[model samples]
Target: IALNAWQDTPLYNDKERAALALCEKLTLSQNIDDDFYLVLAELFDQPSLVTLTVAINAINSWNRMVKMFKPTVEFNER
Candidate 1:
């Protein structure tokens, strides 16, 4: 999928690439350098950046919970 190989593919624009790069860094618990902060700031305002960080953290929390609990879902036919 394009998302799975976003780095190798050319499907994303500058903003998308920036957001994806931030997401990868946050998800992997990597250090965000000053240059990377400048890149993100160029693409997004403070509020937008905060929102994106919150969203990324929320998703990562959910993923961790799922991996730990291994919850299963079921569907019922009406």
Candidate 2:
């Protein structure tokens, strides 16, 4: 409800809102409380899970690699 109550407009749909709410409710259930898991679930709920899953897998691999060695992302280019 916090997100809904915020000043900014809601940029999320019902499914996304539901997932966000479910993530925060922490209702004695699966590990949907995690944003990563919830986002993953929402992403999987899409028709093309295969494509996104592949991307997710790649991102997971990249994240693991980056975590192993603190990657210094350059955002200073102006």
Off by over 4 Å in 2: 1-11, 14-47
- Model 1, position 19, has a per-residue lDDT of 96
lDDT of 2 at 8: 50
* Window of ten residues with lowest summed lDDT in model 2: 23-32
Error of 1 at 67 (Å): 0.6
Model 1, range 1-78, lDDT digits (tens) per residue? 599899989899999999999999999999999999999999999999999999999999999999999999899989
lDDT (tens digit, per residue) of candidate 2 on 1-78: 557553354777665555444444333334534665556566556655455445545666787799899888878776
* C-alpha RMSD between model 2 and the true structure: 7.8
Reference-based TM-score of each model: 0.92, 0.39
